[model samples]
Target: MKKRVGLILLLFSVFLVPANPNPVVAQDGKDREYYETRGDIVWEVPTDKKVIALTFDDGPDPTYTPQIAELLKQYHARATFFVVGSRVNSFPEVARLLANEQHELANHTYTHPDMRRISPGKLAQEVAKTQETIYEVTGAKPQLFRPPGGYYSESIVNIAKRAGALVIMWSWHQDTRDWSDPGVKKIVNKVLKNARNGDIVLFHDYGGNRKQTVQALKEILPELQSRGYQFVTVSELMNHYGTKKVGQGN
Candidate 1:
């Protein structure tokens, strides 16, 4: 009789346990591992088509931002700008202009902290503020987040994922390193020499004298176009490569 009563209690506890058991939270671990094993983050889309994404960081600069927009328009290319929150507040019109021109305006966090060193709460604030600012200014919610300096942690990735963003890093080979004010020829060569299908080339529209970046684009855009390559926003590149599952924006 005592054994029968204990078995009943055990069955009762099992029935009381919640089914589904927070599936989203349960999957977060798997998702986090998926991102980490892919070279710190989604550096490049996996594809064989002659397509690539040109991403700019640290801006919406009053001067260079507009100049970069014009250059993109001229070349009939589309790129993504990972913008800082404070700068977005300072230059909503620039953000709007990029959105208006069909260029993607994504989050680069507020104040641009090295995300690996910050707490998850601080990281969330950085990303949330940027997302709020961008949405307020452009009426488009950003689906992509690029941590400042390309530094990330598992916590960073989970925070971004929970906030509805996919962390975007860039191909090591395709990085222009334009923030160093590299000369136009060097910047141009870095991209043209190592260019490939599904490559995400990093450039900067702000954070210093970006005259070289502007000039490099003038050469890079046309040369890539001539080579039968098409420039795309990060989202479009992901779409072509099927990096994210359908209906799964992350």
Candidate 2:
């Protein structure tokens, strides 16, 4: 009886020991060398210049997306747009414009549901559907994905990964409340005050009113440009740092 009790406790102890926390695991050891050489799929930019990746979410909105794209073109800069599937359908022309203007078209889900609150099937649908629409419009599959309202879960990230996207989260951003018309100057100053190199800046395109948001970008981009910051797509910024590409697994 004593021996059995000791064995049971030892088994429990073994189970209690925590496993390593690695996001990606290579099934074959030989694959690691290749993946290591290829590098990470996505990464935060690590630089000293006042460089930042401007990313717009929930877009292809007829009202704001075209205007924003034109502003980016005028400044000779690039940005990432995480577009919604439904919006893409409603405004296919706008979708084409984003592609034509050389903006990064990324995934923002089909219906723009709060990604953290949905079932895995629903989440996967949201991600995969948007990816399909983006590819359909641009002939370029999205490499980056951002959740609606920046709310996400591990399941969301995993599903997005399976859809062949790297989860993109901004490193520096404050709630612009642009939907509320928080005044153009306030939004511009907010971005400028917290700006940094290798930082991902978040703004909205659809969802709600974005007039102030558009106005803000007009002000902020030139100021940042004058300061010598070159805006690029999210992938460009990540590659400028270092990206570790591992085998694909959900």
Candidate 3:
């Protein structure tokens, strides 16, 4: 009787677990070892060095990209811009200016679609087209790619890797959300309060009126500089200081 009861309990436990294999059900990197190759997915690198990576997305905007680039210059800061392929084609001069200013140009897909919802072939095309576009305008091939909205899967990462770019995700605590047109003060406070060593802060250049971002940068740059934090591109942060094995921002 005891043996039969133990067998029945084991069978019941097996039935209780869900059979769906997608890691989206549990994103905690437990079964993610296979996908986390060579620090391909990065949220923020871990280091004691006072270096931070500021990443801007969805750009090549005629108005805002130039303005942001100027502010970065004023601060003697370097950042990575994840330029959309379509935007690069539309504003090739703006794209060139970013590369010229010593900023790193990373890929952010051609149309910024939800990678999880698209077929694997379409996702591959998005990454390939952006690489070609960035190289065409800047004469530099990007080594990093940020998926639209930070959404990813094994397939997306694999495709990006095949394109020879690691996936770059920003620090969760440092998201400024300036694309939503949040008040300039709010944007400034979010970045200032949460800025940390080896953090990758997210900002946007194209989704909307980016004046708040410009205004906040006006505040953020001077203050972070005062704190003795050096701004470096994403690649520099990873290659120079080394990356944390498991990254957040899925």
- After superposition on all C-alphas, the RMSD of every candidate to the true structure, in Å, is 14.9, 10.5, 9.0
Candidate 1 local lDDT, residue 146: 88
How far in Å is the alpha carbon of 37 misplaced in model 3?
Answer: 7.9
Residues 1-250, candidate 2, lDDT per residue (tens digit)? 9999999999999999754212232323332233323332232566775667888888889988888988998999999888888888889999999889888888888898854367889888878888888888779888777776655445555687788887766653544556657789888988888777787777888778888888898899899998889998887776664343322432
Ranking of predictions according to TM-score: 3, 1, 2
> What's each prediction's clash count?
0, 6, 0
Model 2: residue 115 alpha-carbon error in angstroms = 2.5
Q: Give residue 58's lDDT in candidate 2 (0 to 100).
A: 80
- Looking at model 2, the pairs that clash are 39-243, 39-244, 39-245, 40-243, 40-244, 40-245
Lowest lDDT 10-residue stretch of candidate 1: 19-28
Q: Rate the local accuracy (lDDT) of all candidates.
A: 0.83, 0.74, 0.86
Cα TM-score per model: 0.83, 0.78, 0.84
Off by over 4 Å in 2: 1-43, 243-250
- Say which candidate scores most in lDDT: 3
Candidate 3 vs. true structure, TM-score: 0.84
lDDT of 3 by residue, 147-216 (tens): 8877766677778878888888888788887877879999999999998899999999999789999999
lDDT of 1 by residue, 25-107 (tens): 23234543466465335778778888989999999899998998998999788999999999999998999999999999888
